[model samples]
Target chain A: MSEIVVTHVPHKRSIPFGQEAVGALSIIALGAIGYFLYPDDLAFLTRLIGIAFLVLSLDLVTGYCGVATLGHAAQFGVGAYAAGIACVRGITDPVALLAVGVFAGTIMGLISGALITRFRGLPQLVLSIAVGQLVAALANKLSWLTGGSDGLSGITPGKVFGIFNFDMYSRTAFLFSLGVLVIVFVLLQRFVRSPFGLMCRGIKDDDLRARMIGVSIYPRLVVMYGVAGAVAGIGGALTAISTGVVGLDSVSFERSAEVLVMLVLGGAGHLWGALAGTVIFMIFEHIVAAANPFHWMTLVGLLLILIVVFAPRGLIEPVLSLASRFKRKGEAA
Target chain B: MTNLLEARGVSCSFGGLHVTRDVNFKLTAGDRVALIGPNGAGKTTLVNLITGDIAPSEGQFFMGGDEITGLSIPDRVRRGLVRTFQTTRLFANLTVADNVALAIMQRKRITRRFFSSSTELPEVRAEWSEILSHLGLAKLAYRKVVELAYGQQRLIELAIGLALHPKVLLLDEPAAGVPHDEAPKILEAINRLPSDIAVLMIEHDMDLVFKFARRVLVLAAGRLIFEGSPDEVTADHEVRRAYLGSYADARRAT
Candidate 1:
């Protein structure tokens, strides 16, 4: 009786050990794998990491906040192009390139967010797609700066703190991108559990009730859009730095739609799902397309249909729920 | 400041039809005023006007004597003008405690804090415990709003409104789907609110309204038909015909 334990009223564990440990272990494992097994394909894997970041960004707005969008690649494109431009303009420091990416993504996110969040449902989806296409078109037409369809090249990001130079083997790029992913994941984990995050969830659940409870949904969503943009920007800039080129493909409508598919395939609401979905989709695409380019898309489409019909909450959520159910049952016993 | 909430010449119309017209109303602190009207009498429209869910076509609304004519719903709520829904709009996916704690967090101005645990905080827990207990919902705190019985959901709605620390609470059907025996608990919870906070309840249940309201204002055809003590409301011929009718005789017999 003296050793009786009283948990908190809301039953939220003080230390989010499971999520935090998962975040840490997942990234550390990714780093270890990239260091060992994927040494030859580091460049392709690094590029995939950038796409994962975009998916995570999309998840923040689409999955967590319930903002309907398909043009997230617009923000990603701006980030990549901004970093490429910085490299061309001689702001060669990798850190500065990352900052430029963040800045570019944030600006686009705010501009599009204000317009899109004012509408609901179908209008939002259309507006977001329109924004993505507009950016992509601009990138193609601005030949002098963006280098037309050939993409902006000669982008050489300097060392990590001027010590470890980006090499041909692609070791530094992988580490830098992994480090950024870990920091962003940890921050986002804190965010989704925070009061603001809960309010965002509240807004997603019922915007009317959220308004009745004194939540100004528009501004909250706009800020979320900006944060998501900044994270996605990191991905874009990392892509430019690693690949040494920036293509209009970064902001293409195809990129926008495909990232959404990735989010849905991996799971959207959770940050880890972004990584899981990206790795799975890219690896699957690489293998399948290498064998048959045209037919590979059909398989991907089939996989998406299955996920939509079966794992409607996204792929990982079903697993998480199952684990929790088992835990609940164990407690009862 | 004597009148915590007031409506002056408030009228609203849609297209060519007038839903509510030029109704002046006021509520003082600690007052329990019930707004009663039959279907299509603009009971909901008038409440929406007061809560800023819709703009009154004419006249103004005031909170503590300050004209809040064109404020948004959230802005009105931040000034301590909170309201519960007719259909019970708790966050269906969240726990009952989360629903109530969110309002408290908004009141505390810590709704933006990213790293802090709202549930783990001692003060938040204490507040949830008190409010949940007051509404007989302490045991159901962990239950999701979607999983609760309809009656329990209704009580959770009231608990959330109370958690906002409202100077004036507008309860829209506090027992719409509640069981007959559970209604007393709803009325009892209303009786237990802090005396400083005024309440304007919109209920169709004559017995519950008659028991809870110190004063009752009746609306019919979008007009203020009667405003008096419960006894006067029970005796008024116009209220009896337009809104109450046979229910007045039943209330009077009690």
Candidate 2:
């Protein structure tokens, strides 16, 4: 018999330049900048991190898998509610709460994914919107369980690793959220580069061709939705942990639409774009809303219009292209 | 040898119109069969039925003695039944290497691995490299499919088919839309496929068909009218009337 040998080829990079590296570096750099820039307002930064998870999760389903969804906030809400309810019932180890959120979000994702993946294009979008509306309505109707419109309160999360207490100053919460974001960012980077990720990309491009190539499209899409759910769920869990509340707003149609806008503002397919979009849109909105008070919506609308018309791919497209071009020049020199 | 693929009285109808009617054929290992007919002859419909793109209304398909009529498109593919589209369907935005690599990974059942990069896998790399090099596509591996010439894209489809390690390969007008000069390259690649795999080619070009097929199956208006050797195909009265028409008449006059 011929000697069977398996050797791995090292991923060699003469220059440490690629989207994965850029995305990771950007996340860390932004996290550091946020900590420094908003030292007193870590709560705002923490909230942004929570929303960032929702955007990233949306990207996985909508961007990577070519799953069209407007009601992605449903998964996020389910995660938030799950974590909040868990905390009230006394399962408040912050990490364990996150796991609960992830689990709840995944189940919600699978259910929504099963229903939504049954249709294509307009129907898929419509079904997703319907699912979102249905979930929000359910949350509203179940006043006893969800605290109705008043929101669920009295959520007291335990310490981080039984050490760092969740303080009133919000420093610990910010750092915890940032840490989880970075870890998630790294894993998602690997996920989108994986064979499964590539398969999703192929499915996104041409589902017919994907099927012809022997891919069972439905199951893969559902699993991807589940993954997206997990991501979004953790974000929801973080929101509950930091804010100590889960309200109707957590599972609202408005919230769902807002996350979609953030994703669009960033660019949907790129992970960094999702994160960057959330940061920019939230920060911009926060500042503008503070400055204008009443007319802030107009400015946000104008910014969106301008971005859509000029940089249709999202605001991050130009930056990524520029980075690639700069790398090419560096190589030439 | 037991037939690799056998279709028995397979018929498909959409609404009231029958697209494929009572089609039957058998493909054993190492068979080179050309399927030829007019534009609406249901040649592709027959292929679709075999590949499970559309289920047969009144027939059964067997692969190595097992019925596969109820199988999904991907299920048929997993069973080594592969087809290239009439209009070259590739992941246009992806690099040619990636397009081929997707198939290689699928064949190896490693498409679900999320931790490692797909391209960096040694076995996947080995298989795709072999396939791309085999098709003279190694130079264009990094180039996006959208940037390649139409002929080159068709070759990539063949590369994808080969990567799947197919037992039965279907070519749905493999040379369609390819420039006349570049069409033969596709035929050459098809010719170079592994001898163990059976191939069924649908071609409008008679010259290419004559060169590629050892046995030929002719379809006309949803029925298989003729099945014979390449030489005998030209002499058949029915095939001449239905498919060859003026060419056969002109030969008769000469």
Candidate 3:
């Protein structure tokens, strides 16, 4: 499976020489630099990494597959809750929590994807919101197990390979989360370039034409949705493991909406946009909230409006186009 | 002999209005057939029923004598019954080559590989070249569908269906928007299709219909009015009254 090859498509690239490799390096560099630069705020940065994972997952279905969802946080919450429950049940391995979280997310994704992929437009949005709310309601009503409104506490995870412990500063957690993000992002880059990923883009572009050429739309979409769920689940598990807590707010509607906003801000289809949007939004939230908690949300709302008005294709497209234009000119010269 | 693709007593209605009425049709292996009718003549509706885009309220479909009455559009395509739309249906944002590549990938059923791009596949490359060169679309291969002119897009549309390797192809107005000068590339592409594969083109252009189709079927207001060789069809008085009036007038006027 390891061979040196080139990819023609821009949305997907796995080679170590191109933008994919550069992006991978950047994420690692960010995590390392952030850990050193903001040792005190490592926890916040790690959480942003986790949120970035969730937005990456959303980008799979919403950006590439053209699915409209505002309830992706349901997958994240389920993953977090699953990881949290595993920890509560005496499975404290960091690796174990991540696995359980991913499994739970994938299963939730498959089921919800089946439901969500069945409808379009208004019904789709309703189904997404309905599913998220239902999960939130279930989590709230089942207080005896989930710790309900109080949130799940005592989610103590054992250290990395029994060496690194998740300390007060969360340095280990940041590295672990960064490691996971790198791995997942690499895998995603490979996937969106794959023939299957191309088909998903094809379906997103013109489902009827996709069908005209013998693509079974529903099943493929279902699988895509499920995969998205798995990614979000990983995000959830990271959140639970790093913080050692799982809250009802993890699966709340606002969580889903926030990720959507993050995806839009950075650009939805491109994986790197997930990182850009998440980092920008989280830093903005921290800065504004610290300055004035009430006005921070208003600032965020205005920022989203500005982005929609000026850079409708999201922040990445313009930058990428400009970079490519310069490169083309350089090549010509 | 078993027909390659058959539609028997097929009928469909939208709410209370009948769109297609008891349309019985057949295509043997390698026959060149055409379907022509006035606007709203239920030509496309019949094609949809055959392709299983929508199910017929009455009657059945057969592909090589096997029951495919309830099959979905993609499944019908998988069975080698492929079609192009009346209006172009293409991946507007994707390159023309990728558009053709997507169809070839779907046809090869190798669209699920997670590590490699489909364009890198030898099979995909081979098919992509053949289809593009055949339609004279090689120059426009790298250009996105949205950037191409309407005529170029129509040619690309035919190239996509051709990439599917249809056992029986139903082309809906393949030359509808194409100018006369550029229409031959489309005709050449159709002419270059394998002799064993059957073709049924739906066209309003009698010149194209006569030039490409050895046999023709005329539909009017959702009924099969005439089915015969091209010369016989053009000479028939009934066809003249219902559909050929304009074409015949244009010819006489010229």
Which fraction of the native contacts appears in each prediction?
A: 0.62, 0.66, 0.72
Q: What overall lDDT, based on C-alpha atoms, would model 1 receive against the true structure?
A: 0.87
- Candidate achieving higher TM-score, 1 or 2: 1
Q: Distance (Å) between predicted and true CA of A70, model 2?
A: 1.6
Q: What's the lDDT for all of these models?
A: 0.87, 0.89, 0.88
Give the alpha carbon lDDT tens digit for every residue of B32-59 in model 2: 9999999999988888888887778899
Say which docking band candidate 3 falls in. medium
Each model's total of backbone clashes: 1, 0, 0
Highest-DockQ candidate: 2
In Å, residue B37's CA in model 2 sits off its true spot by 0.9
Q: For candidate 1, lDDT tens digit of each residue in A103-125?
A: 99998888888888888999899
Complex DockQ, candidate 1: 0.50
Chain B structural similarity (TM-score) per candidate: 0.96, 0.96, 0.95
| Shift in Å, residue B53, candidate 2 | 1.1
Off by over 4 Å in 2: A1-22, A325-333, B249-254
Give a tens-digit lDDT track for model 3, residues B62-105.
99889999888888899999999989999998888889999988
DockQ of 2: 0.52
